[model samples]
Target: MMNNAKHYNLSLDKRLADELKSIGFIRAEQDLSMWCGKERSYFSSMRCRGYGLHIGSLTLMAARIADRMNTTADVRERARLRMALNIVNAVVQEKCRLREQELLTA
Candidate 1:
């Protein structure tokens, strides 16, 4: 007989981190270092109660970067950036359940 053992899944926080990282959320080494240099409580808050906050911050950062890249580009690039920003906004606002003001300040 084949053994059927139950497998435990990761907690929601870890899952969120994995998903965000998998979705092209790359940052500069300096930015990553600065972010990492924060107090452990910051990561703990993100890991525990700030999943939405982190998602908001990531999406906003992506949008900001896209805007900078699109400044001297063509319409096609702007459209692409718009779409990405919109999707990020929607995900952070709806899927991640972030309040508008909280997301804005994130």
Candidate 2:
């Protein structure tokens, strides 16, 4: 049973690493877009399709990181859930204004 569960830890670590890399890429792209004085596409079809995905992945990464750092599974799980929620909250707060503006112009 212990060995069977070992994969979970490895899986989580892999996922966290991938998520962090993705977030870094997304942030860099966003920064470039901002520097060019243009709106970065928000989960657009033409390009930057992973913009929204980054937000979610970032949240998951936060949770997984917290879980890995925590001592107890219960505490880790709770922290992970809260971290995920906070990520979504942050993404919503960050994007709400742009979305509202788009809606207003439409």
Q: Estimate each model's TM-score.
A: 0.36, 0.32
Clashes of each: 0, 0
TM-score of 2: 0.32
What TM-score would candidate 1 get against the native?
0.36
In candidate 2, list every pair of residues with a backbone clash: none
- Once fitted onto the true fold, the runs of candidate 1 whose alpha carbons sit more than 4 angstroms away are 1-53, 62-66, 95-106
lDDT of 1: 0.43
Which lDDT tens digits does candidate 2 get at residues 1-106? 3333334333333343344345442244443233223455422321323223333443444455445546455765555445544444454344444445556766
* 10-71 per-residue lDDT for model 1 (tens digits): 13334333443444442322332133344435545554543323554555555674665568
Question: Candidate 1 at residue 106, lDDT?
Answer: 52
Query: Any runs in candidate 2 off by more than 4 Å, and if so which?
Result: 1-73
